[model samples]
Target: MQNKLRIIGGAWRSRNITFSDAPGLRPTPARVRETLFNWLHYDIAGKTCLDLYAGSGALGFEAASRGAKSVVLVESNAQVCLSLKNNVAMLSAQQISIAQTEVSRFLAATAQGFDVVFIDPPFTKDLVPTTCLTLENNGWLNPHAKIYIETERSLTLSGLPANWQVLKHKTAGEVAYQLFERG
Candidate 1:
């Protein structure tokens, strides 16, 4: 059976969003997503968001439901991208865009900038720091944009972008969330 997930808040609260427990994919817990939106407050409204390593497009979908002006989800896996595309269609999110590409490739190719960027790379590899750096280096992140990063509790991010500052951080079980604001 497929796992049905609900949108945490905004216009689509309690609506079901489909997800799969497949290899190389892990959706952030609902509680964590809620905390994230809470931290963002009214910033989620009308902001463009980039969902890197968008497993189920859960984060981007939530942003859309919460009034994000646009959501761009980048995923390489064909199956996962299909699911993301389908879910966006089901939600009737006109501002949601799906890109079927590896996160690294998308990072290099993307010209679109976002007001908020969500990165939740696979925990098996230490990709978060490098990916964040790549985005910052490539100008994929707009100045003063907010970036939400999720990682295993013990993972350390060294040498972050000089302009980004940690605005808040919280831990939930094995997961740790960090919110950064670009200066």
Candidate 2:
């Protein structure tokens, strides 16, 4: 089975993209995306972005639709990666690239810095802290880059980089999302 999501704004607004019904693949809700993008309104255009754990490619696609210079979506599942590639082709999104690999492995090997990054790992895996550390320690973020994270509402966000400061936070139902800036 497949699930579809609509791009709520930008050039692709109201366009629908499909994703496979894979386990642990939860796309960011439209409401949360709307709020996140609002927070990123001024920063997204012409920026390079990394969408780690790019399950459904919602965040990355949204960034590309909003005029991001480039977007990298890293996901390990073969089925999900295929869906992401198809969507990229469907949109003719020259700015988006899909990296088929584990989030940690991709972070370990890539040194390219990005202006923005979306971290929405599978719920209850406790992946955020370590992933954030890897991104910071491996020089994967540009100076003063913006990082967005979505996690289970109860997950405690600790062990993150010392210089990262929370800029915005909100909870809707079972999810808690936040935006952070590298200081």
Point out the worst 10-residue segment of candidate 1 by lDDT.
17-26
Per-model TM values vs. the true structure: 0.96, 0.99
The lDDT leader among the candidates is 2
Q: Which ten residues in a row have the lowest lDDT in candidate 2?
A: 103-112
Writing each residue's lDDT as its tens digit, candidate 1 over 1-183 gives 357788989899899888666686878899999999999987889899999999977889999999999999988888777777778888788899988888888888847778999999888698987898898888887778999999999987887888899999999999999999989
Scored against the true structure, residue 113 in model 1 reaches a CA lDDT of 78
Model 2 TM-score?
A: 0.99
Model 2, 145-171: lDDT tens digits are 999999999998999999999999999
